[model samples]
Target: MPIWGWPMTEILFFFEVVLAGLLAGTMYSLVALGFVLIYKASATFNFAQGAMVFFAVLSFVGFMELGLPFVLAFLVTILLMIAVGYATERLVIEPLTGQSEDTMLMATIGLAFVLQGLAQAVWGVEVRRLDLGIPDFPIPWLADNLGIFVSALDVTAGVVAGVLIIVLSLLFRFTKMGLGLRAVADDPGAAASIGIPLKNIMLLVWSTAGIVALVTGMMWGARAGVQFALVDLALKALPVLIIGGFSSIPGAIVGGLIIGVVEKTLEVYVGPYFGGGIEGWAPYVLAILFLLWRPEGLFGEKIIRRV
Candidate 1:
């Protein structure tokens, strides 16, 4: 039998895992970013964001299947996402108007189911391949007896995610609209008093979240194909968000990376020793511990609510 020590193959696997984690973190960041954005603006969890990602990915791929070129298909999909966002804000969120935050959260939960059903009905519940136009070449550089390898797709995912993160940072820094978004997120009441249109701002926040969803869909769909994976992914993102603090963008990204790394490592080394795999519960375990030790997370603002 081979020695139990960490072999070259194992070392290579770890590298790939780290690379994959970075990419996965980006997608998770997008999901967590949705929470931050909506919570910053409306103080609601906006749980439907995951379903939004699922629908956006499925819709984009579906349009592509209908013979539209990549750019056209994406444009159409983005428009639909914008409409979905506006409709959610107008119909569900607006009608509840002034209700307790729990009420709005419940509304989003309902909206999540509605979106899920729509995705299944429209996409036939089958996994559809998404053409993200990334070159799917194998990384043969790590060859020989070691034969350490990673897919081009994983690299592309990391690059795309990095690009999106940089773009978001720039947008929030340079653009007038982004400035408005930050102001609203920081203080919606003050923003309104200063002439930022609340309605347009809300629409813009949701649409931006949706666009982030599109990038998420493209990257993940490129991996597992587009389907109900969005739901599963949303569940995965919860712990990341919990540990990262719900409002900080960098926290979300960092939380995703931590979850990805810890879960993968635990599954590899500690999982089989106990039973089969422990990846499923790793994040929750870490989240709970973090909560106990530091309830505010690594980057969360400590808001002291006096009794």
Candidate 2:
């Protein structure tokens, strides 16, 4: 026991847990980023993002199995996702332009099932391992010098996610295309009135979202072997989006961190009392509380309507 009435070792362990949780939260943020991108551009909740993640990584694994080099496989997968994006815009969204939100949402729900089945048919229902060449073990120096353990893979993930967020932020903040995207996100009719190409912008946004899905899939598949269950990971992101807000990128990142920290801490300290699965559902409970307290989320914009 120390001056704080807790063991020094316990305090160190608590810090370690928090660091690990924040790192893990980056993965959740990556997934939520996909949702934010699409929602920002189209104001539609893309229910098929998880399926896109599953298909992208599954395709990457399949290509590798067929003797493609790692880099080649990744390039091919990116191309495929781009094509998927194109097809989605041309075949699905184009035909249903001006549809109600519920209709578009139902379309995405159907799209999810279709993508899942298509991936299954093409890649088969076998779980495959993805190795990104990053070691998943603890950094020996940290453990030896500071008595805290952190995974190299989690660190790599955090760095990748941070870089991605920065790049996206830059793209949205300082580019001609970014201006067009922002204009469309704000109001499609007004954007088109100013000569912005709505269809082209939507295509670009969806394609970018597909690319985001690919990055998300690669990270997640590397951690938890590629399988159908990975689709459920999207459900985990729902809590993240709800807590963070469906349309705010920063909200996604912060919400994911909060969920990760809360889940890990609760699972560690309070789990033993409740039989140990608190991590699975605690974030959702927190999300519900957020819904009750701040329906638009911490960073979400409140909508105003005149009757």
Candidate 3:
């Protein structure tokens, strides 16, 4: 019998659901960041990003299974991802320079299949657990005091995502390389004319995207187990990218939070009417609505076509 007409426990539970959704959305933003970096730099959609995530985590788990220490394995995986990025830029993207966007996209799609096959060949198709030593249980003080349950791992993820977004924002806003990247993204021909080195910038962008994929893979793998199905997680980022704008990092973060909150709230409050599973499709539905109304997204620049 609360003054608001809802039970105190129910109100606490609603807040808990929203918090959980926000945390989950952070991970979604991490994945979308990879797509944003590549698209911002090269205007390439990078269809293979999901496969890259799958490969990165599978490779890390395989390395760990080979008796490598956790830290060593992580370092090794970073190096491996960097190498993969370099190879992709040189072999797949460079060859198709100046080609139609469809051609470049097709190349990445092919690369995705190649990476997926290579990972399965090397590590097999078995699902594997990735224990990062973060506890997944609820925080004691919050549960005891406020009756709100939240996972320590989710909190850690939110913090990690926040730090990453801040670092990237600084990197893109304050550094010489950031300026060069912005120039290249705006017009590669002009950037190259001014000695910006388009190839090198693209290489750096792809490399950074690979590192992002690795981080995303680790977080998702730790939560859901490392498996081929992890590739599908990238699909979840599509709605985020659409809502946040594919070229905006901060937009990605905000879009993720919106999706997360809506998904969780709908699943809890409105799911019973539909017999549950509302969370699975709710984000996409919202994304579609955004597409119809705001195709450029909240922070995206509006395209101006000159006749």
Candidate 4:
């Protein structure tokens, strides 16, 4: 009954906790993916990313409450996000195009508050349920065979996250538009010189980021409910990005899984030793430690400068 100097039950419990953490990490990666997309296509930090998650889920659930079917509600939410992106590009990003980075950062912070207030005003401050038809029950087969308990909801989210990452990778690799996005990310001036419309490209990038926000919102909302707290869930993505790399999609996935697993496992195992509540600060501490070692992140490019 002993395994690796630990009881078999203890080992099984550890595996179960790790599995749960991996699933939760997918949600973090989904949120961080939005930040990566926006920051990659444009140099903006997108302080509004988390707010967008709150708004998107609120809108989707609101639409569902109005008798719209899930599919219809989802499509409508997409269109709304596209409009939000266009308005953002036109009214915020474009006007401040040549401004300092600090100026853009402030604008996004303002946008975040604006979005949070607007969503509350429109949808009310009450929490709402979001059902994507993914059950909250554990899969009996997995639990019975492997002594691991995993939520069906978490499994669905993980699959969706994986599919999205793969689809995005293919899009960036094979599409002309995707190539243009890469060019803009590399050098906006050079891309503009080659006849790629910088304005249009930026718009495309924002809208795409909007889509990412929507996906993050749906997953987080399903797990935590459609509410203000979902906005805070976006903060988890920051550490994930710090661990992975700001501009690398693969980094987002890996970093998110790491944060998710580490935080959850620490909370369950080591939390009591620290008087509980270790989940909140554990990821940040880990990220800070990793950053001290490598500022650019695990998948991010190395910065080399000659003085």
Predicted candidate 4 versus true structure: per-residue lDDT over 91-188, tens digit per residue: 99988876776888899999999988999999999998887888787899988898788889999889999999998888887999889989988888
- Estimated TM-score per prediction? 0.89, 0.97, 0.96, 0.96
Mind giving the per-residue lDDT tens digits that candidate 1 earns over 1-307? 2246878666777776676666666667767776777776676788888898898999898888889999999999999999999998899877886787788888999999998899889877888877666756566674444465556777776667667777776777798987888787667778889899888978988898899888887878887788897778777788888888877677888898888878877776778899956877788989999899888777878856667
In terms of lDDT, model 2 sits at: 0.89
After superposition, candidate 4 runs with Cα above 4 Å error: 304-307
Whole-model Cα lDDT of every candidate shown, in order? 0.79, 0.89, 0.88, 0.89
lDDT of 2 by residue, 1-307 (tens): 6647988988998998899789878889988999899998888889999999998999999999999999999899999998999899898887987898899999999999999999999889989999999888899999899998998888888888888888888998899988999899889889999999998888888888888899999888888889998899777888999988888888989988888888888988999999998888888899999899988987888966668
- Candidate 1, pairs of clashing residues: none
Give all candidate RMSDs, comma-separated: 2.9, 1.3, 1.4, 1.4
- Model 3: per-residue lDDT, tens digit, 1-307? 6647988878877888999899999988888888888988888888888899999989999999999999899899989988899899899988887888899889998999999999999999999999999978899998899788888888888888888889888998999988899998888888999899887888788888888888889889989999988887777888998999988999889998888888888988899999999777888999999999999887777856678
Residue 194, candidate 1: how far off, in angstroms? Answer: 2.6
Candidate 2 residue pairs that clash: none
The candidate with the higher lDDT, 3 or 4, is 4
By TM-score, highest first, what's the ranking? 2, 4, 3, 1
Candidate number with the higher lDDT (1 or 2)? 2
The TM-score, computed over Cα atoms with residue i paired to residue i, of candidate 3 is: 0.96
Provide the lowest-lDDT 10-residue window in model 3: 298-307
